[model samples]
Target: MTRDAGRPVATPSQTVGPFFHFGLTANAALGTLAKDGVRGERIGLRIRVLDRDGPVPDAMVEIYHADAEGQYGQAHFDGFGRLPTDGDGTCVFETIRPGAVSTRADGAQAPHVNVCLFARGLLRHVYTRIYFSGDAALDEDPLIALVPPARRSTLLASQPSGEPAVWEFTIRLQGEGETVFFAL
Candidate 1:
């Protein structure tokens, strides 16, 4: 039906964005979760974001976890961190290894860090969990049981053979070896 031609067409849809370095800084302190006097096994977490094309330098990563006592809401540790990826698609966090948090079922959960990712192509941020490699509690965690055996490795962060205190996790947005993101 040809009516009055005074209406404007709607704008085309677009991805989240490419706001890589608008307000982010390279400050190392922003990613530090462990403060002075906070006690635990000091460790370094290295996260990498990738896609089929290559590294996602503009991505931002956030993490939250409990303290060494398997507790949260402590006065010493805030247990939260946020950092932007660098040119190598990497962000490093200096945090202590968290203790195993207990579950509602009276069972212990694996020591893990909760992660959130935000990047240009995503309409909304994605959520995931980073479990430490060699944690015996992984066998009993209820959530880990839900994931398939072959894919469970995607949720684990591994310590390089020579780097005793450094753990690395890679998030692949597409193609092979993609990290397992959670629904919530």
Candidate 2:
């Protein structure tokens, strides 16, 4: 008789947290921005975050950004713009591509979306920013550079489905590919 030579396989375990029960509600701030006067058409962004075990139904995901012109001034908007995730841990946003921002360095900042995470288990919110894929400006982005090169893909948004103009991205809370977090 021959003994099994394969390495022992470990089953993935699920981790539970307190912030998993929060429900997403539409906010006036986000609503107004969606209808803001921007030249370019608004695109829908769907974000899904899976818990360690699987998809977290009630995960609270929030996305913030400026109008089509990429203006986030107080006069243009009031209160922090936030959109929550749906029942499937998915959040949808109707907005336009953010305009370029000036960075500390000589180069300009790339267009991107800022993401904030608040789940059942965590007491405070985790801050993460998502970048666009194939953006020529991404090469010179200062914020994206902060993240490790190996993990940069996690923050880049992908368009798996939907129209050619529409953009989509899925986020994994923990495990193989996790979104990159910032200090602030």
Best by lDDT: 1
lDDT values of the candidates? 0.90, 0.68
User: What are the RMSDs of all candidates, in order?
Assistant: 3.5, 11.3
Candidate 2, overall lDDT?
0.68
Q: For candidate 1, which ten residues in a row score worst on lDDT? A: 1-10
Q: In model 2, what are the clashing residue pairs, if there are any?
A: 18-120, 18-121, 19-119, 19-120, 19-121, 20-120
| lDDT by residue for model 2 (1-184), tens | 3235676656655453544444344463563355555455566676787767877666666676655555565465421455555667776666666766665577777877777777766556778777779989888888788778999998888776547656778778778887777767
Q: Using TM-score as the measure, which candidate wins?
A: 1
lDDT of 1 by residue, 1-184 (tens): 2234776656668897678467777666879999888999999999999989999999989999999988987889979999999888999999999999988889988999999999998999999999998898999999999999999989999989999999999998888888888898
> What local lDDT does model 2 show for residue 44?
66
lDDT at residue 43 of model 1 (Cα atoms): 97
Badly placed stretches (over 4 Å) of model 2 are 1-32, 74-80
